[model samples]
Target: MLARLATLCPAPILQRVDRLIEPLRATCSTKVKAGSVKQEFEKQDELKRSAMRAVAALLPIPEVGKSPIMANFTSQIRSNPELAGLFKRIKKDSASAPSTDSVELS
Candidate 1:
């Protein structure tokens, strides 16, 4: 799971999670009992979830406010009215497209 998450998540997020789990990793050993191993696994899972929630909370939501990249892009688009209009048309078209929730059978 950690390997998969490492591949999927950004480096900064993974680094944060690694820091959060460093203590747990330090205590892990090959001599542990099966029950203790299970307990440790549960603890690690909990820590991972907490780290994810923390990262998620830190991220800027579009509905709340624009992130730096989004803000810059918005500014650029506003500076070019034609580009802004083109984006608006594209957005409208995408919004009006039919939903693909229902799959058509061959």
Candidate 2:
């Protein structure tokens, strides 16, 4: 009955139930020992920590805008007289391209 109850309950509630039943279980020949229960809890904690570390390692680091190298290169281009003028001309040409909003209807 306690085993079934443990399955239905959340971790915190299940832990409390385990604590409540510990003395009764200790007296029962068929029940698990307190040391075994403590070992199981430690194993579960280690598994959770390992899973969290794996997830953190798999995720990419986030930063605002372009990467450092690209950002530095763009800044350099904008600061140079010849490159800055060329970049402005290209930007203006791209901006002047026809937009879907201005499409003619037949």
Best candidate according to lDDT: 1
Q: Can you write out model 2's per-residue Cα lDDT over 1-106, one digit (the tens) per residue?
A: 3323333543544234324433322222133446677876666545433332221221112221123432343355446564455444444443554221121111
Q: Model 1 residue 72 lDDT?
A: 41
Candidate 1 residue runs with Cα over 4 Å from true position: 1-66, 98-106
What would the TM-scores of all predictions be? Answer: 0.30, 0.31
Model 1 lDDT at residue 21: 37
Candidate 2 pairs with clashing backbones = none
What ranges in model 2 sit over 4 Å off?
1-64, 98-106
Estimate, for each residue in 1-106, the C-alpha lDDT of model 1 and write its tens digit. 3333433553554335435333432332113456677877677545544433332232222221223433343445446564445444444443454322121111
Candidate 1, RMSD to the unseen true structure: 18.8
Number of backbone collisions per candidate: 0, 0
Model 1: lDDT equals 0.38
What TM-score does candidate 2 get on C-alpha atoms?
Answer: 0.31
